[model samples]
Target: MANVTVVDHPLVQHKLSIMRNRETSTGGFRRLLREISLLLGYEVTRDLELTTMRIETPIEPMDAPTLEGKKLVFASVLRAGNGLLEGLLDLVPAARVAHVGLYRDHDTLQAVEYFFKAPTDLHDRLVIVVDPMLATANSAIMAIDKLKERGATNLRFLCLLAAPEGIKRFTEAHPDVPVFTAAIDRQLNELGYIIPGLGDAGDRMYGTK
Candidate 1:
Protein backbone atom coordinates (compact mmCIF):
# COMPACT_ATOMS: atom_id res chain seq x y z
CA MET A 1 0.00 0.00 0.00
CA ALA A 2 2.98 2.33 0.48
CA ASN A 3 3.43 2.69 -3.25
CA VAL A 4 -0.28 2.90 -4.03
CA THR A 5 -2.74 5.73 -3.44
CA VAL A 6 -6.49 5.16 -3.55
CA VAL A 7 -8.36 8.32 -4.42
CA ASP A 8 -11.53 8.28 -2.33
CA HIS A 9 -13.04 11.56 -3.34
CA PRO A 10 -16.85 11.40 -3.26
CA LEU A 11 -17.28 12.42 -6.88
CA VAL A 12 -14.71 9.89 -8.01
CA GLN A 13 -16.61 7.08 -6.28
CA HIS A 14 -20.00 8.20 -7.64
CA LYS A 15 -18.81 8.50 -11.22
CA LEU A 16 -16.97 5.18 -10.98
CA SER A 17 -20.14 3.49 -9.69
CA ILE A 18 -22.08 4.69 -12.69
CA MET A 19 -19.37 3.39 -14.98
CA ARG A 20 -19.64 -0.03 -13.37
CA ASN A 21 -23.29 -0.49 -14.16
CA ARG A 22 -23.80 -3.09 -16.88
CA GLU A 23 -26.36 -0.94 -18.67
CA THR A 24 -24.31 2.24 -18.92
CA SER A 25 -24.01 3.32 -22.55
CA THR A 26 -20.71 3.88 -24.31
CA GLY A 27 -21.25 7.61 -24.43
CA GLY A 28 -22.06 7.68 -20.72
CA PHE A 29 -19.06 5.57 -19.75
CA ARG A 30 -16.67 7.77 -21.65
CA ARG A 31 -18.20 10.95 -20.32
CA LEU A 32 -17.86 9.72 -16.76
CA LEU A 33 -14.27 8.58 -17.30
CA ARG A 34 -13.30 12.02 -18.53
CA GLU A 35 -15.08 13.64 -15.61
CA ILE A 36 -13.59 11.43 -12.89
CA SER A 37 -10.11 11.74 -14.33
CA LEU A 38 -10.03 15.41 -13.39
CA LEU A 39 -10.67 14.56 -9.76
CA LEU A 40 -7.96 11.90 -9.81
CA GLY A 41 -5.59 14.33 -11.45
CA TYR A 42 -5.92 16.54 -8.44
CA GLU A 43 -4.32 13.94 -6.19
CA VAL A 44 -1.79 12.64 -8.71
CA THR A 45 -0.31 16.07 -9.29
CA ARG A 46 -0.63 17.33 -5.75
CA ASP A 47 3.09 17.34 -5.16
CA LEU A 48 4.24 19.09 -8.32
CA GLU A 49 7.13 21.33 -7.41
CA LEU A 50 6.62 25.08 -7.55
CA THR A 51 9.02 27.99 -7.52
CA THR A 52 8.52 31.70 -7.03
CA MET A 53 8.40 33.88 -10.12
CA ARG A 54 8.24 37.62 -10.60
CA ILE A 55 4.67 38.64 -11.35
CA GLU A 56 2.55 41.76 -11.67
CA THR A 57 -0.74 41.98 -9.85
CA PRO A 58 -3.49 44.55 -10.35
CA ILE A 59 -2.40 46.30 -7.16
CA GLU A 60 1.40 45.70 -7.22
CA PRO A 61 4.23 43.41 -8.28
CA MET A 62 4.62 40.05 -6.53
CA ASP A 63 6.56 36.82 -6.71
CA ALA A 64 4.09 34.17 -7.72
CA PRO A 65 4.52 30.43 -7.57
CA THR A 66 4.75 28.52 -10.82
CA LEU A 67 5.45 24.92 -11.76
CA GLU A 68 9.16 24.07 -11.82
CA GLY A 69 10.99 21.67 -14.10
CA LYS A 70 10.31 20.21 -17.53
CA LYS A 71 6.84 20.12 -19.09
CA LEU A 72 4.79 17.30 -17.59
CA VAL A 73 4.20 14.31 -19.84
CA PHE A 74 1.05 12.22 -19.87
CA ALA A 75 1.85 8.85 -21.39
CA SER A 76 -1.32 6.99 -22.23
CA VAL A 77 -1.41 3.24 -22.73
CA LEU A 78 -3.27 3.34 -26.03
CA ARG A 79 -7.07 3.20 -26.30
CA ALA A 80 -8.33 2.81 -22.75
CA GLY A 81 -5.73 5.17 -21.42
CA ASN A 82 -6.93 7.78 -23.86
CA GLY A 83 -10.24 8.06 -21.98
CA LEU A 84 -8.45 9.00 -18.76
CA LEU A 85 -6.01 11.27 -20.60
CA GLU A 86 -8.78 13.54 -21.88
CA GLY A 87 -9.65 15.07 -18.52
CA LEU A 88 -6.06 15.39 -17.33
CA LEU A 89 -5.26 17.26 -20.53
CA ASP A 90 -8.11 19.63 -19.84
CA LEU A 91 -6.60 20.29 -16.43
CA VAL A 92 -3.15 21.02 -17.87
CA PRO A 93 -3.29 22.16 -21.47
CA ALA A 94 0.44 22.91 -21.53
CA ALA A 95 1.44 19.37 -20.62
CA ARG A 96 2.97 17.12 -23.27
CA VAL A 97 1.33 13.86 -24.34
CA ALA A 98 2.59 10.42 -25.32
CA HIS A 99 0.93 7.26 -26.57
CA VAL A 100 2.15 3.73 -26.00
CA GLY A 101 0.11 1.18 -27.88
CA LEU A 102 0.18 -2.38 -26.63
CA TYR A 103 -1.93 -5.49 -27.13
CA ARG A 104 -2.08 -8.65 -25.06
CA ASP A 105 -0.93 -11.88 -26.60
CA HIS A 106 -3.79 -14.33 -26.07
CA ASP A 107 -1.74 -17.44 -25.53
CA THR A 108 0.76 -16.07 -23.04
CA LEU A 109 -1.25 -13.14 -21.69
CA GLN A 110 1.83 -11.01 -22.30
CA ALA A 111 1.93 -7.47 -23.61
CA VAL A 112 3.26 -6.59 -27.06
CA GLU A 113 3.95 -3.04 -28.13
CA TYR A 114 2.86 -1.97 -31.59
CA PHE A 115 3.41 1.78 -31.29
CA PHE A 116 5.40 4.18 -29.13
CA LYS A 117 5.78 7.89 -29.59
CA ALA A 118 6.78 10.25 -26.80
CA PRO A 119 8.37 13.56 -26.12
CA THR A 120 12.14 13.77 -26.64
CA ASP A 121 12.78 15.31 -23.22
CA LEU A 122 11.47 12.40 -21.19
CA HIS A 123 14.55 12.44 -18.97
CA ASP A 124 13.84 15.96 -17.82
CA ARG A 125 10.08 15.65 -17.45
CA LEU A 126 7.84 14.15 -14.85
CA VAL A 127 5.92 11.43 -16.68
CA ILE A 128 2.52 10.24 -15.55
CA VAL A 129 1.28 7.01 -17.11
CA VAL A 130 -2.46 6.52 -17.48
CA ASP A 131 -4.60 3.47 -18.10
CA PRO A 132 -8.23 3.01 -17.12
CA MET A 133 -7.71 -0.44 -15.66
CA LEU A 134 -4.68 -2.08 -14.05
CA ALA A 135 -5.95 -5.64 -14.15
CA THR A 136 -3.17 -7.98 -15.18
CA ALA A 137 -0.70 -5.03 -15.39
CA ASN A 138 1.20 -6.57 -18.31
CA SER A 139 0.53 -3.54 -20.46
CA ALA A 140 1.46 -1.09 -17.72
CA ILE A 141 4.63 -2.99 -16.82
CA MET A 142 5.85 -3.16 -20.38
CA ALA A 143 4.83 0.43 -21.01
CA ILE A 144 6.90 1.60 -18.04
CA ASP A 145 9.81 -0.56 -19.13
CA LYS A 146 9.79 1.12 -22.51
CA LEU A 147 9.50 4.56 -20.97
CA LYS A 148 12.54 3.90 -18.79
CA GLU A 149 14.49 2.67 -21.79
CA ARG A 150 13.76 6.01 -23.38
CA GLY A 151 15.20 7.94 -20.38
CA ALA A 152 12.20 8.65 -18.18
CA THR A 153 13.04 8.80 -14.48
CA ASN A 154 10.53 10.81 -12.48
CA LEU A 155 7.28 8.92 -12.97
CA ARG A 156 3.86 8.15 -11.55
CA PHE A 157 0.92 5.98 -12.65
CA LEU A 158 -2.78 6.82 -12.75
CA CYS A 159 -5.72 4.48 -13.25
CA LEU A 160 -9.45 4.36 -12.64
CA LEU A 161 -9.39 0.90 -11.08
CA ALA A 162 -6.85 -1.71 -10.01
CA ALA A 163 -6.77 -5.34 -9.03
CA PRO A 164 -4.84 -6.56 -6.00
CA GLU A 165 -2.84 -8.93 -8.11
CA GLY A 166 -1.99 -6.24 -10.58
CA ILE A 167 -0.90 -3.84 -7.88
CA LYS A 168 1.30 -6.48 -6.32
CA ARG A 169 3.05 -7.21 -9.56
CA PHE A 170 3.36 -3.57 -10.52
CA THR A 171 4.88 -2.44 -7.23
CA GLU A 172 7.29 -5.35 -7.20
CA ALA A 173 8.39 -4.58 -10.73
CA HIS A 174 8.83 -0.84 -10.10
CA PRO A 175 8.73 0.23 -6.49
CA ASP A 176 10.03 3.66 -7.31
CA VAL A 177 6.90 4.53 -9.30
CA PRO A 178 3.88 5.60 -7.28
CA VAL A 179 0.38 4.52 -8.30
CA PHE A 180 -2.85 6.52 -8.03
CA THR A 181 -6.27 5.00 -8.67
CA ALA A 182 -9.85 5.88 -7.91
CA ALA A 183 -10.67 2.39 -6.76
CA ILE A 184 -9.12 -0.99 -5.96
CA ASP A 185 -11.61 -3.66 -6.84
CA ARG A 186 -11.65 -7.32 -5.76
CA GLN A 187 -9.25 -9.90 -7.05
CA LEU A 188 -8.92 -10.64 -10.73
CA ASN A 189 -11.01 -13.49 -12.12
CA GLU A 190 -9.75 -16.61 -13.87
CA LEU A 191 -9.98 -14.93 -17.25
CA GLY A 192 -7.85 -11.98 -16.05
CA TYR A 193 -10.65 -9.47 -15.56
CA ILE A 194 -11.04 -7.39 -12.42
CA ILE A 195 -13.88 -8.69 -10.29
CA PRO A 196 -16.72 -6.19 -10.00
CA GLY A 197 -14.92 -4.02 -12.52
CA LEU A 198 -16.58 -1.85 -15.12
CA GLY A 199 -16.07 -4.59 -17.71
CA ASP A 200 -13.62 -4.14 -20.57
CA ALA A 201 -12.80 -0.43 -20.47
CA GLY A 202 -11.72 -0.18 -24.11
CA ASP A 203 -14.82 -2.00 -25.35
CA ARG A 204 -17.13 0.02 -23.17
CA MET A 205 -15.56 3.34 -24.04
CA TYR A 206 -15.40 2.68 -27.78
CA GLY A 207 -18.33 0.27 -28.13
CA THR A 208 -15.98 -2.14 -29.85
CA LYS A 209 -17.15 -5.23 -27.95
Candidate 2:
Protein backbone atom coordinates (compact mmCIF):
# COMPACT_ATOMS: atom_id res chain seq x y z
CA MET A 1 0.00 0.00 0.00
CA ALA A 2 2.90 2.34 0.61
CA ASN A 3 3.82 2.77 -3.03
CA VAL A 4 0.67 1.66 -4.82
CA THR A 5 -1.46 4.13 -6.75
CA VAL A 6 -4.90 2.99 -7.83
CA VAL A 7 -6.21 4.91 -10.82
CA ASP A 8 -9.85 5.43 -9.85
CA HIS A 9 -10.90 7.86 -12.55
CA PRO A 10 -14.52 7.60 -13.63
CA LEU A 11 -13.62 6.71 -17.19
CA VAL A 12 -11.33 3.94 -16.00
CA GLN A 13 -13.98 2.46 -13.73
CA HIS A 14 -16.63 2.66 -16.47
CA LYS A 15 -14.42 0.98 -19.03
CA LEU A 16 -13.37 -1.73 -16.58
CA SER A 17 -16.99 -2.53 -15.81
CA ILE A 18 -17.71 -3.10 -19.48
CA MET A 19 -14.62 -5.24 -19.86
CA ARG A 20 -15.69 -7.46 -16.98
CA ASN A 21 -18.89 -8.52 -18.69
CA ARG A 22 -18.65 -12.00 -20.21
CA GLU A 23 -20.89 -10.84 -23.05
CA THR A 24 -18.26 -8.38 -24.25
CA SER A 25 -16.67 -9.53 -27.47
CA THR A 26 -12.95 -10.05 -27.83
CA GLY A 27 -12.65 -6.95 -29.98
CA GLY A 28 -14.55 -4.93 -27.40
CA PHE A 29 -12.42 -6.23 -24.56
CA ARG A 30 -9.21 -5.35 -26.40
CA ARG A 31 -10.48 -1.88 -27.26
CA LEU A 32 -11.58 -1.15 -23.70
CA LEU A 33 -8.22 -2.27 -22.32
CA ARG A 34 -6.38 0.09 -24.66
CA GLU A 35 -8.66 2.95 -23.63
CA ILE A 36 -8.40 2.25 -19.89
CA SER A 37 -4.65 1.89 -20.17
CA LEU A 38 -4.28 5.45 -21.45
CA LEU A 39 -6.01 6.68 -18.30
CA LEU A 40 -3.86 4.42 -16.20
CA GLY A 41 -0.77 5.52 -18.10
CA TYR A 42 -1.62 9.11 -17.25
CA GLU A 43 -1.47 8.39 -13.50
CA VAL A 44 1.56 6.11 -13.76
CA THR A 45 3.64 8.76 -15.49
CA ARG A 46 2.18 11.76 -13.67
CA ASP A 47 5.22 12.41 -11.55
CA LEU A 48 7.83 12.14 -14.29
CA GLU A 49 10.74 14.53 -14.05
CA LEU A 50 10.49 17.59 -16.25
CA THR A 51 13.03 20.23 -17.24
CA THR A 52 12.63 23.40 -19.22
CA MET A 53 14.33 24.17 -22.52
CA ARG A 54 14.41 27.48 -24.35
CA ILE A 55 12.40 27.24 -27.56
CA GLU A 56 11.22 29.72 -30.16
CA THR A 57 7.49 30.19 -30.61
CA PRO A 58 5.52 32.32 -33.03
CA ILE A 59 5.48 35.21 -30.59
CA GLU A 60 8.83 34.75 -28.82
CA PRO A 61 11.35 32.29 -27.42
CA MET A 62 10.46 30.81 -24.05
CA ASP A 63 11.36 27.95 -21.74
CA ALA A 64 9.14 24.95 -22.44
CA PRO A 65 8.94 21.89 -20.22
CA THR A 66 10.09 18.50 -21.48
CA LEU A 67 10.79 15.16 -19.90
CA GLU A 68 14.33 14.94 -18.52
CA GLY A 69 16.97 12.24 -18.97
CA LYS A 70 16.67 9.33 -21.38
CA LYS A 71 13.40 8.19 -22.91
CA LEU A 72 11.28 6.09 -20.56
CA VAL A 73 11.09 2.35 -21.09
CA PHE A 74 7.98 0.19 -21.11
CA ALA A 75 8.89 -3.38 -20.17
CA SER A 76 6.00 -5.52 -21.32
CA VAL A 77 5.64 -8.98 -19.83
CA LEU A 78 4.85 -11.22 -22.80
CA ARG A 79 1.54 -11.51 -24.68
CA ALA A 80 -0.92 -10.19 -22.12
CA GLY A 81 1.23 -7.22 -21.28
CA ASN A 82 1.05 -6.19 -24.91
CA GLY A 83 -2.62 -5.30 -24.43
CA LEU A 84 -1.68 -2.58 -21.95
CA LEU A 85 1.50 -1.73 -23.88
CA GLU A 86 -0.44 -0.52 -26.91
CA GLY A 87 -2.23 2.28 -25.06
CA LEU A 88 0.80 3.33 -23.07
CA LEU A 89 2.66 3.66 -26.36
CA ASP A 90 -0.19 5.81 -27.66
CA LEU A 91 0.31 7.97 -24.58
CA VAL A 92 4.09 8.25 -25.09
CA PRO A 93 5.01 7.09 -28.52
CA ALA A 94 8.67 7.98 -28.05
CA ALA A 95 9.08 5.64 -25.12
CA ARG A 96 11.37 2.67 -25.60
CA VAL A 97 9.99 -0.86 -25.46
CA ALA A 98 11.13 -4.10 -23.87
CA HIS A 99 9.59 -7.55 -24.02
CA VAL A 100 10.09 -10.22 -21.41
CA GLY A 101 8.63 -13.49 -22.59
CA LEU A 102 7.35 -15.49 -19.66
CA TYR A 103 4.47 -17.84 -18.99
CA ARG A 104 3.03 -19.26 -15.81
CA ASP A 105 3.57 -22.95 -15.24
CA HIS A 106 0.05 -23.93 -14.14
CA ASP A 107 1.03 -26.69 -11.77
CA THR A 108 3.57 -24.65 -9.84
CA LEU A 109 2.24 -21.23 -10.82
CA GLN A 110 5.87 -20.24 -11.27
CA ALA A 111 7.26 -18.05 -14.00
CA VAL A 112 9.57 -19.40 -16.69
CA GLU A 113 11.38 -16.95 -18.90
CA TYR A 114 11.92 -17.99 -22.48
CA PHE A 115 12.96 -14.74 -24.10
CA PHE A 116 14.08 -11.26 -23.15
CA LYS A 117 14.91 -8.24 -25.25
CA ALA A 118 15.42 -4.68 -24.05
CA PRO A 119 17.31 -1.49 -24.61
CA THR A 120 20.98 -1.65 -23.67
CA ASP A 121 20.86 1.53 -21.60
CA LEU A 122 18.32 0.36 -19.08
CA HIS A 123 20.27 1.82 -16.16
CA ASP A 124 19.87 5.29 -17.59
CA ARG A 125 16.11 5.25 -17.91
CA LEU A 126 12.97 4.70 -15.88
CA VAL A 127 11.35 1.33 -16.55
CA ILE A 128 7.64 0.72 -16.18
CA VAL A 129 6.64 -2.94 -16.33
CA VAL A 130 3.17 -3.68 -17.69
CA ASP A 131 0.92 -6.70 -17.34
CA PRO A 132 -2.85 -7.00 -17.65
CA MET A 133 -3.30 -9.00 -14.46
CA LEU A 134 -1.16 -9.48 -11.40
CA ALA A 135 -2.97 -12.51 -10.05
CA THR A 136 -0.05 -14.47 -8.69
CA ALA A 137 2.65 -11.82 -9.35
CA ASN A 138 5.06 -14.54 -10.46
CA SER A 139 5.64 -13.12 -13.89
CA ALA A 140 5.71 -9.56 -12.63
CA ILE A 141 8.27 -10.33 -9.95
CA MET A 142 10.52 -12.31 -12.28
CA ALA A 143 10.33 -9.66 -14.99
CA ILE A 144 11.39 -6.94 -12.58
CA ASP A 145 14.14 -9.13 -11.22
CA LYS A 146 15.54 -9.66 -14.71
CA LEU A 147 15.41 -5.95 -15.43
CA LYS A 148 17.21 -5.07 -12.22
CA GLU A 149 19.82 -7.64 -12.98
CA ARG A 150 20.44 -5.79 -16.21
CA GLY A 151 21.04 -2.55 -14.22
CA ALA A 152 17.59 -1.01 -14.01
CA THR A 153 17.21 0.83 -10.73
CA ASN A 154 14.22 3.13 -11.15
CA LEU A 155 11.19 1.01 -11.93
CA ARG A 156 7.43 0.73 -11.55
CA PHE A 157 4.86 -2.02 -12.07
CA LEU A 158 1.48 -1.37 -13.69
CA CYS A 159 -1.44 -3.74 -14.05
CA LEU A 160 -5.16 -3.62 -14.80
CA LEU A 161 -6.14 -5.75 -11.82
CA ALA A 162 -4.21 -7.19 -8.90
CA ALA A 163 -5.03 -9.70 -6.19
CA PRO A 164 -4.17 -9.10 -2.54
CA GLU A 165 -2.08 -12.23 -2.45
CA GLY A 166 -0.26 -11.17 -5.57
CA ILE A 167 0.31 -7.64 -4.29
CA LYS A 168 1.64 -8.91 -1.01
CA ARG A 169 4.13 -11.23 -2.66
CA PHE A 170 5.11 -8.62 -5.23
CA THR A 171 5.69 -5.81 -2.77
CA GLU A 172 7.57 -8.08 -0.44
CA ALA A 173 9.80 -9.23 -3.27
CA HIS A 174 10.46 -5.75 -4.64
CA PRO A 175 9.69 -3.02 -2.13
CA ASP A 176 11.52 -0.33 -4.03
CA VAL A 177 9.47 -0.75 -7.18
CA PRO A 178 6.20 1.19 -7.01
CA VAL A 179 2.95 -0.35 -8.25
CA PHE A 180 0.04 1.16 -10.17
CA THR A 181 -3.24 -0.57 -10.95
CA ALA A 182 -6.89 0.15 -11.61
CA ALA A 183 -8.17 -2.15 -8.85
CA ILE A 184 -7.02 -4.63 -6.20
CA ASP A 185 -9.35 -7.58 -6.07
CA ARG A 186 -10.29 -9.60 -2.97
CA GLN A 187 -7.98 -12.54 -3.42
CA LEU A 188 -6.48 -15.13 -5.74
CA ASN A 189 -8.37 -18.38 -6.22
CA GLU A 190 -6.77 -21.75 -5.51
CA LEU A 191 -5.81 -22.03 -9.16
CA GLY A 192 -4.01 -18.64 -9.00
CA TYR A 193 -6.60 -16.54 -10.78
CA ILE A 194 -7.90 -13.27 -9.45
CA ILE A 195 -11.39 -13.58 -7.99
CA PRO A 196 -13.92 -11.29 -9.68
CA GLY A 197 -11.22 -10.41 -12.16
CA LEU A 198 -11.96 -9.93 -15.84
CA GLY A 199 -10.80 -13.52 -16.32
CA ASP A 200 -7.60 -14.45 -18.20
CA ALA A 201 -6.64 -11.22 -19.87
CA GLY A 202 -4.64 -12.92 -22.61
CA ASP A 203 -7.53 -15.25 -23.32
CA ARG A 204 -10.10 -12.50 -23.37
CA MET A 205 -8.05 -10.05 -25.38
CA TYR A 206 -7.00 -12.55 -28.03
CA GLY A 207 -10.05 -14.90 -27.98
CA THR A 208 -7.89 -17.82 -26.97
CA LYS A 209 -9.17 -20.82 -25.01
Candidate 3:
Protein backbone atom coordinates (compact mmCIF):
# COMPACT_ATOMS: atom_id res chain seq x y z
CA MET A 1 0.00 0.00 0.00
CA ALA A 2 1.18 3.50 -0.71
CA ASN A 3 1.89 5.87 2.14
CA VAL A 4 -0.72 8.65 2.46
CA THR A 5 0.68 11.52 4.47
CA VAL A 6 -1.85 13.87 6.07
CA VAL A 7 0.22 16.95 6.84
CA ASP A 8 -1.10 17.98 10.23
CA HIS A 9 1.60 20.55 10.70
CA PRO A 10 0.17 23.41 12.73
CA LEU A 11 0.81 25.87 9.95
CA VAL A 12 -1.02 23.77 7.39
CA GLN A 13 -3.97 23.20 9.68
CA HIS A 14 -4.19 26.85 10.57
CA LYS A 15 -4.19 27.95 6.95
CA LEU A 16 -6.71 25.31 6.01
CA SER A 17 -9.01 26.55 8.73
CA ILE A 18 -8.82 30.03 7.33
CA MET A 19 -9.43 28.78 3.81
CA ARG A 20 -12.57 26.95 4.88
CA ASN A 21 -14.25 30.10 6.06
CA ARG A 22 -16.60 31.41 3.36
CA GLU A 23 -16.00 35.02 4.24
CA THR A 24 -12.30 34.95 3.42
CA SER A 25 -11.64 37.45 0.62
CA THR A 26 -10.33 36.41 -2.77
CA GLY A 27 -6.95 38.01 -2.13
CA GLY A 28 -6.69 36.30 1.21
CA PHE A 29 -7.67 32.96 -0.28
CA ARG A 30 -5.08 33.20 -3.01
CA ARG A 31 -2.38 34.29 -0.59
CA LEU A 32 -3.16 31.54 1.90
CA LEU A 33 -3.22 28.91 -0.82
CA ARG A 34 0.20 29.94 -2.00
CA GLU A 35 1.61 29.91 1.48
CA ILE A 36 0.12 26.51 2.21
CA SER A 37 1.43 25.13 -1.05
CA LEU A 38 4.97 26.22 -0.18
CA LEU A 39 4.69 24.54 3.19
CA LEU A 40 3.35 21.34 1.65
CA GLY A 41 6.01 21.40 -1.03
CA TYR A 42 8.66 21.39 1.67
CA GLU A 43 7.30 18.16 3.17
CA VAL A 44 6.76 16.49 -0.20
CA THR A 45 10.37 17.11 -1.20
CA ARG A 46 11.89 15.69 1.98
CA ASP A 47 13.30 12.54 0.32
CA LEU A 48 14.74 14.15 -2.79
CA GLU A 49 18.14 12.71 -3.61
CA LEU A 50 21.17 14.81 -2.67
CA THR A 51 24.92 14.76 -3.39
CA THR A 52 27.80 16.29 -1.52
CA MET A 53 30.13 18.78 -3.18
CA ARG A 54 33.03 20.93 -2.12
CA ILE A 55 32.24 24.64 -1.93
CA GLU A 56 33.96 27.67 -0.57
CA THR A 57 32.16 29.48 2.22
CA PRO A 58 32.77 33.08 3.22
CA ILE A 59 35.79 32.06 5.29
CA GLU A 60 36.98 28.71 3.96
CA PRO A 61 36.24 25.64 1.79
CA MET A 62 33.52 23.34 3.07
CA ASP A 63 31.58 20.30 1.93
CA ALA A 64 28.01 21.11 1.00
CA PRO A 65 25.09 19.04 -0.15
CA THR A 66 22.86 19.82 -3.10
CA LEU A 67 20.11 18.06 -5.04
CA GLU A 68 21.10 15.23 -7.31
CA GLY A 69 21.06 15.27 -11.11
CA LYS A 70 17.38 14.51 -11.63
CA LYS A 71 15.41 17.72 -12.04
CA LEU A 72 11.74 18.05 -11.04
CA VAL A 73 8.81 18.30 -13.44
CA PHE A 74 5.63 19.76 -12.01
CA ALA A 75 2.39 18.55 -13.59
CA SER A 76 -0.44 20.86 -12.68
CA VAL A 77 -3.98 19.54 -13.08
CA LEU A 78 -5.17 22.74 -14.72
CA ARG A 79 -6.85 25.84 -13.26
CA ALA A 80 -6.67 25.23 -9.54
CA GLY A 81 -3.39 23.40 -9.72
CA ASN A 82 -1.83 26.53 -11.14
CA GLY A 83 -2.35 28.24 -7.79
CA LEU A 84 -0.41 25.53 -6.01
CA LEU A 85 2.21 25.53 -8.71
CA GLU A 86 3.13 29.18 -8.18
CA GLY A 87 4.39 28.64 -4.65
CA LEU A 88 6.19 25.42 -5.53
CA LEU A 89 7.92 27.19 -8.40
CA ASP A 90 9.09 29.87 -5.99
CA LEU A 91 10.88 27.11 -4.08
CA VAL A 92 12.16 25.22 -7.15
CA PRO A 93 12.42 27.82 -9.83
CA ALA A 94 14.25 25.55 -12.24
CA ALA A 95 11.65 22.80 -12.27
CA ARG A 96 9.82 22.36 -15.56
CA VAL A 97 6.04 22.60 -15.63
CA ALA A 98 3.37 20.67 -17.50
CA HIS A 99 -0.37 21.16 -17.64
CA VAL A 100 -3.06 18.49 -17.61
CA GLY A 101 -6.58 19.76 -18.01
CA LEU A 102 -9.50 17.73 -16.70
CA TYR A 103 -13.06 18.57 -15.90
CA ARG A 104 -15.72 16.56 -14.11
CA ASP A 105 -18.91 15.85 -15.99
CA HIS A 106 -21.86 17.06 -14.03
CA ASP A 107 -24.04 14.05 -14.62
CA THR A 108 -21.48 11.28 -14.60
CA LEU A 109 -18.98 12.85 -12.21
CA GLN A 110 -16.21 11.38 -14.35
CA ALA A 111 -12.98 13.07 -15.29
CA VAL A 112 -12.69 14.17 -18.88
CA GLU A 113 -9.27 15.19 -20.06
CA TYR A 114 -9.15 18.05 -22.52
CA PHE A 115 -5.46 18.90 -22.62
CA PHE A 116 -2.13 17.35 -21.64
CA LYS A 117 1.44 18.38 -22.28
CA ALA A 118 4.54 16.97 -20.60
CA PRO A 119 8.28 16.84 -20.92
CA THR A 120 9.80 14.36 -23.35
CA ASP A 121 12.12 12.96 -20.69
CA LEU A 122 9.38 12.57 -18.13
CA HIS A 123 10.69 9.20 -16.99
CA ASP A 124 14.04 10.71 -16.06
CA ARG A 125 12.61 13.43 -13.82
CA LEU A 126 10.87 13.46 -10.49
CA VAL A 127 7.24 14.52 -11.14
CA ILE A 128 4.99 16.22 -8.67
CA VAL A 129 1.28 16.34 -9.68
CA VAL A 130 -0.58 19.18 -8.00
CA ASP A 131 -4.24 20.07 -7.49
CA PRO A 132 -6.20 21.63 -4.65
CA MET A 133 -8.87 19.00 -4.06
CA LEU A 134 -8.99 15.21 -4.28
CA ALA A 135 -12.71 14.68 -4.25
CA THR A 136 -13.82 11.74 -6.39
CA ALA A 137 -10.26 10.74 -7.29
CA ASN A 138 -11.33 10.13 -10.86
CA SER A 139 -9.38 13.07 -12.28
CA ALA A 140 -6.24 12.39 -10.27
CA ILE A 141 -6.14 8.70 -11.16
CA MET A 142 -6.66 9.43 -14.83
CA ALA A 143 -3.99 12.12 -14.76
CA ILE A 144 -1.49 9.72 -13.22
CA ASP A 145 -2.35 7.07 -15.77
CA LYS A 146 -1.62 9.47 -18.57
CA LEU A 147 1.66 10.55 -17.01
CA LYS A 148 2.78 6.93 -16.68
CA GLU A 149 1.85 6.38 -20.27
CA ARG A 150 4.13 9.27 -21.13
CA GLY A 151 7.01 7.41 -19.37
CA ALA A 152 6.81 9.06 -15.99
CA THR A 153 7.50 6.43 -13.32
CA ASN A 154 8.70 8.62 -10.47
CA LEU A 155 5.67 10.58 -9.39
CA ARG A 156 3.95 11.98 -6.32
CA PHE A 157 0.53 13.59 -5.84
CA LEU A 158 0.06 16.69 -3.70
CA CYS A 159 -3.14 18.39 -2.65
CA LEU A 160 -4.46 20.76 -0.03
CA LEU A 161 -7.59 18.76 0.87
CA ALA A 162 -8.82 15.24 0.13
CA ALA A 163 -11.88 13.21 0.86
CA PRO A 164 -11.51 9.82 2.53
CA GLU A 165 -13.21 8.07 -0.35
CA GLY A 166 -10.95 9.81 -2.81
CA ILE A 167 -7.83 8.81 -0.87
CA LYS A 168 -8.89 5.17 -0.73
CA ARG A 169 -9.72 5.13 -4.39
CA PHE A 170 -6.51 6.89 -5.39
CA THR A 171 -4.27 4.62 -3.32
CA GLU A 172 -6.04 1.50 -4.53
CA ALA A 173 -5.62 2.58 -8.13
CA HIS A 174 -1.99 3.70 -7.87
CA PRO A 175 -0.29 2.06 -4.96
CA ASP A 176 3.19 2.94 -6.17
CA VAL A 177 2.75 6.69 -5.91
CA PRO A 178 2.72 8.38 -2.52
CA VAL A 179 0.24 11.16 -1.66
CA PHE A 180 0.64 14.29 0.45
CA THR A 181 -2.26 16.38 1.68
CA ALA A 182 -2.82 19.08 4.26
CA ALA A 183 -6.13 17.64 5.43
CA ILE A 184 -8.58 14.80 4.73
CA ASP A 185 -12.25 15.60 4.83
CA ARG A 186 -15.09 13.23 5.69
CA GLN A 187 -16.70 12.24 2.40
CA LEU A 188 -17.96 13.34 -0.98
CA ASN A 189 -21.55 14.39 -1.33
CA GLU A 190 -23.87 12.99 -4.00
CA LEU A 191 -22.83 15.88 -6.20
CA GLY A 192 -19.23 14.67 -5.99
CA TYR A 193 -18.03 17.58 -3.91
CA ILE A 194 -16.28 16.88 -0.61
CA ILE A 195 -18.58 17.44 2.35
CA PRO A 196 -17.70 20.53 4.32
CA GLY A 197 -14.97 21.27 1.82
CA LEU A 198 -14.34 24.79 0.64
CA GLY A 199 -16.55 24.79 -2.43
CA ASP A 200 -15.09 24.63 -5.92
CA ALA A 201 -11.43 25.28 -5.30
CA GLY A 202 -10.96 26.58 -8.80
CA ASP A 203 -13.75 29.06 -8.45
CA ARG A 204 -12.67 30.02 -4.94
CA MET A 205 -9.10 30.64 -6.00
CA TYR A 206 -10.10 32.70 -9.02
CA GLY A 207 -13.14 34.38 -7.53
CA THR A 208 -15.25 33.13 -10.38
CA LYS A 209 -18.12 32.14 -8.12
TM-score rank order: 2, 1, 3
Tens digits of lDDT, candidate 3, 1-209: 24899889999999999999999988899999999999999999998999999999999999899999878999999989999999999999999998999998999999999999998999999999999999999999999999999999999999999999999899999999999999888899999999899999999889896
- Pairwise TM-score winner, candidates 2 and 3: 2
lDDT of each: 0.95, 0.95, 0.94
**What lDDT would candidate 3 get against the real structure?**
0.94
In angstroms, give how far residue 13 of model 2 lies from its true place: 0.5
Rank by lDDT (best first): 2, 1, 3
- For 49-157, candidate 2 gives per-residue lDDT tens digits of 9999999999999999999999999999999999999999999999999999999999999999999999999999999999999998999999999999999999999
C-alpha lDDT (0 to 100) for residue 24 of candidate 2: 100
List model 1 lDDT by residue over 155-195, tens digit each. 99999999999999999999999999999999999888899
Which candidate ranks first by lDDT, i.e. highest?
2
